[model samples]
Target: MADLRDVAMDSKAWPFQEARALAKRYEKAPPEKGHVLFETGYGPSGLPHIGTFGEVLRTTMIRRAFELISDIPTRLICFSDDLDGMRKVPDNVPDQAMLRENLQRPLTSVPDPFGEFESFGHHNNAMLRRFLDTFGFEYEFISATEFYASGRFDETLREAARKYDDVMKIMLASLREERQQTYSCFLPIHPETGRVLYVPMKEVNAEDGTITFDDEDGREWTLPVTGGHVKLQWKPDFGARWAALGVDFEMYGKDHSTNTPIYDGICEVLGGRAPHHFTYELFLDETGQKISKSKGNGLTIDEWLTYASTESLSYFMYQKPKTAKRLHFDVIPKAVDEYHQQIRGFKGQEPVQQLANPAWHIHGGQVPESDLVVPFSMLLNLASVAGAEDKATLWGFIRRYAPDATPKSHPGLDAAVGHAVRYYNDRVKPHKTYRMPDVSERAAMEEVLAALDEWQGEADAEALQNMLYAIGKEHRFDPLRHWFQALYEVLLGASEGPRFGGFIALYGIEETKALIVKALRGDLAHEEPIDI
Candidate 1:
């Protein structure tokens, strides 16, 4: 392992470099206190989803990088905005009528549809914490409801109340004319109806820290600024949290970039500087629409974990956080394969180069030692072809390739076999398309089948790859790339697959030869490739 000091000083990994720069900037002009704080917020309107996982995972990577560069005391606050009003009921949860009845009420005041917690907000908050715990995240969980109820935000609340006109001016500049008439920086909870009201305030007394507003019942009411009587609007709330907690760093989605300046202005007006801001691109679904928890369009965290390892999910987040990427089931196999490749290559790289690799951050700067055996994608294909239902079936093929390998000694591969089994059953089985080889492709396949016997089952992937390419050239397949495509179409019934050499090595030369023979005999032939 390389010294972290060397890596931290010169590493070009974006997250590490970003963390190092942030630390230096903050150290020159430390915050109100000596500590550095990072904050990630979650709106607990629904269960913790994949987007939630990405936010926390990316934040944790930055935190890890920051720790390597600076010895300053640091903390990450996973804040849940549970005090937000329930505008609409989530379609996924039970008891929709109950939630609909509580619309306009604070989330904490709504009854839990699941009946597992005191309130809907509490249940959701608990789910978020549980999800974070599963990833071994180190953070303090803060609830907006608790913070407001405990009077921890009293000072910030009072400050917002005093600067109400200033905050409103900044917020209203971004709103439409019709919205400006009803917008207020402070949303007071109506004492009579127990509903969070968003109407215009009649009067704001800076000296008394109270706001006078009219309720839905046409009654004028004055509420105290503290003790949970009022909650700031979202933009103002973001500022208040930054000031109150002295947050040093936070990242948000690009969709919020337009409003970030307003948040900064509000924080400055409240006598606090906004945290260092990093805006990341949003995660989109297969249709290229933004992933919405309310819409349930994207893959859930549970779905991701079911098909891939957590470390693979972390690797997906590690790759270019600022770039937009579509996240769906189709991404899991590639992500898993990429994670394996990184881990296999970790030990051979130069120390500085290793520092730039995602596996370093994914594994918290400590890369584990492991021999390359088989890729997860290959395992999925093997499981599909073999109809494997358990570890024993996949391990049977693995042992034939690597005779010494054991399930007990190779837990990662073992676990991948299980994930691949489920992934194949759920995603690949229904969509499989096997194409019969054309006249030229059959000639190439015959050459490949003959060459397998000469392999002796001992050549490495590179050697076998060269042999396959030579066979493709010998058979004169147009463009040459079609050789491998022919192999995939014949053996796996897919137009693309794992590296042929690697797949043959793991699936065994004898078995691979038989499968090709079977394909040549038309046992695996299907309709021609669809013209997509």
Candidate 2:
């Protein structure tokens, strides 16, 4: 354990790097709170999106890394800013007319369109909790509405009121001239209409812990900032929440990067130290547009889970967090296969390398051994060629290639087999385009067929790969990869595939020969011209 800790102190992995900085914060002494607080904030105006998962999962990774090098304990808080008003209705939810009526109301006051929870905020919070629970995340859920209403933030609210002008000076500089005139750090909720009023504050009485504001209806009211009568504006809330929680570390998307100073300044003004921040690049959709929670344009947590394992999603989250990544169906198979690949490689890696492996951080150091011998891409290709509608059909070939393995013995592989079949049918089958082999390609196919028929011993993948490599050279193909591409296009109806020899070994020698014969006969080719 001491040696592992020594290695972690010098590790270059991002989580360890972030954790080391946090550990340095308390080098002189422990925090007054006794344990460091790590926080990830969520706005509950919309359902929990993939961004929420990335933030929490990545924070947890750092927390796990911190435990390895430091003796101080840590707590993770998944804070939901549900008290914020719903400025606009989300397009993805049901019952739009009902939501339209609730604009400018705190999300907790808006009725749930799903009719399951007390309000829209509660519904979204429940969804977030459920999603986190699905991944076994250890976190304490805190609702802004509950925190404010229960007076847990009373001291911070009072502090903000006392430091109102100071907070305004920090915020006003960042806003446009037009917005600077009417903006106040406090937004008062209307006493009668139950709506959050956005009007300018006429007076901020710090001594009384209250603010004077006029509603849109032109009635003046004085409301205490405590007990949920008023809440801080979004920008102020960001820093105030940090101050109120004494958060040791927090992470947000790049969209919030510009506001870091405002949040930090406000925290300092309120007599609380600013937390360490890590801002990751936001995720993009297939077209490179930023993903939105309201627009629901990109993939969802449930959608990814339906096609792949949860660990693969975590693996995706762990990679190059500062770089923007396209979160779509195309990336899933690679994530799945690569995650298992890491697991397979863990046993052979040196201890330092293992500490740097993503699989270690993902599984919280107890990295599981991978039982999935067949790669996910290979399974998808096999599924495409076999027209597999069920796991049983894929298992038929899996049994032939690996005689002793079964669904019970290889649970990970079994789940991957099921995922492959679903991914192939839904994502692969619809767009598949097969074409006739050109004259030279047809000659290569006949040669491959004759070589398969003449083979006598067991189907050895390496030997077969060598034979195919020789075949590609014999055909005078400029790049040897073109021969493999021709084989994939003609036989699998896709431009990419697993290693041809490995595919043949898994699918059986006779089966591949039959497929080649079909391709040469134009039975597998579509009537349409190949688009190359």
Candidate 3:
């Protein structure tokens, strides 16, 4: 076992630093049975979304970090709060009428809208598992329904029941005046109706860990805490789960930050210590509105993977999770590019520095040594300019630029090219507006074309970039500001684009001259030049 102090002092990775702190905390007071448990929670009310993936992915990264510094047995439990009642039908699911009929019933008991699984919760749980499995996440999945029904929560339930009054006080203090009138920490499942009822317990016997509550029909019933007849409200449930599982660490969104103290208090009252808590800012839509599962308004896991690699998505989550970030289609290209940049940066770094690189955490310390043949954004531009749809056409340009490269050797680039072509056709091409270069711009582009045509030797992106800058300065176009814009306007019809030097080199000098000739001839011209 590595000395945690030595490990802490050895690495600069934030995840490792957090791991060291957790290790020290655990050493001060080890958990029961000498195991460290990390937990990530999900609500099976709807299909697993990108936010769900983010929580688990981030937790898994922390878990990986902990393993590097400690020899203690570690476990990551991906728990689904499936026992929760279905308060309302999800907007994205089918068979709305059937779901509406099952409202207020435990999600595990509600009929599956898709009719594939036994219940709504089961269907969603399966979807969640499938999504996680797609990314090859390493964790054990525990369903709340099974955990509660199988008596895994028996001890915790009894403790919660014994601390019922204390828990009530903690919950009611946080609720509004109107809500306190009917609020109870324990909600009993009606024996007959099977619906989870929110009415206050009519009588409580702490000694026996049992409660008496009336159903909606006014029939009084008594149930023991050992059975799955009662469940704690969400806030209490959060605390109870921490105590039950002996969780050492967990992370949730910022929306739950305010309730964290209350949950910690509830855990303390229940004779358990609070786990380490991390609250990340919420993911917002492109419009800067909160992305909600019920509203179904943001990019989903499937939607992201459809156009980008899983590593790219992981990299997106790896960045400053505590700060709010926008997750939308528009951000995908940048994420892809950043992922490549990290991969490239990882290759040249020393061992200690590489350990601290984001790619180290992003790939769980197995950073791949591979060259980025082309940036994804560059591929998008290449696809747009050349009208390339398949890998053959894209690879044609790649081979021309780098004769040593092949589609077989650069699978990442190949796959990205396919996605870029589809993305360009679907998202970028429709609203694309090409701007015609004015007279001065035309003369400058012609000069660039003539220079490229006369050049015979190999021209790298740096040389080409320098030449473009010199041309811009010679033509009084201000190379620092507007030189790239002229090339973009004439070639790709956008104000901004990939580095023109790299794009020109990758697209080949002959193709570049031809594109310039077309632009000068007004064949690719727009109605008017767009002002920057």
Candidate-wise lDDT, in order: 0.85, 0.92, 0.83
Residue-level lDDT of model 1, residues 1-532, one tens digit each, is: 2376766778889888779768866756665587789899999887778888888888888888888877787899999999999998888899999899999889999999999999999999988888889899999999999999999999988888888888888998999999999999889998877788988999999999999988877889998989999998888899889988888888999998988898898889999977788889999999999998777888888899998888889999999888999999999999988888898888889878788999989888778865437888788778766766667888888897788878788888778888998887788877887767889888878878778767664757777888888988888878887888888877787778888888877777777788887778876665322111
- Candidate 1 vs candidate 3: the lDDT winner is 1
Weakest lDDT window of 10 consecutive positions for candidate 1 = 523-532
Q: For residues 1-532, could you state the per-residue lDDT of candidate 2 as single tens digits?
A: 9999999999999999999999989999999999999999999888889989999999999999999999999999999999999999998999999999999999999999999999999999999999999999999999999999998999999999998999999999999999999999899999998998888999999999999988898889999999999998998998999899898899999999999999999999998899998999999999999999899988899999989999999999999999999999999999998999899999899988998999999999999999898889999988988889899989999999899889999999999999999998899988989988999999888999999999989998888999999999999988988999998999999898888899999989998888887788887785432111
- lDDT for model 3, please: 0.83
In Å, residue 465's CA in model 3 sits off its true spot by 1.3
Task: Give the winner by TM-score.
Answer: 2
The positional error of residue 297 in candidate 2, measured at the CA in angstroms, is: 1.4
Clashes of 2: 0
Between prediction 1 and prediction 2, which has the larger lDDT?
2
Clashing residue pairs in candidate 3 are none
Alpha-carbon runs more than 4 Å astray in model 1 = 1-3, 453-463, 526-532
Q: Global lDDT for candidate 1?
A: 0.85
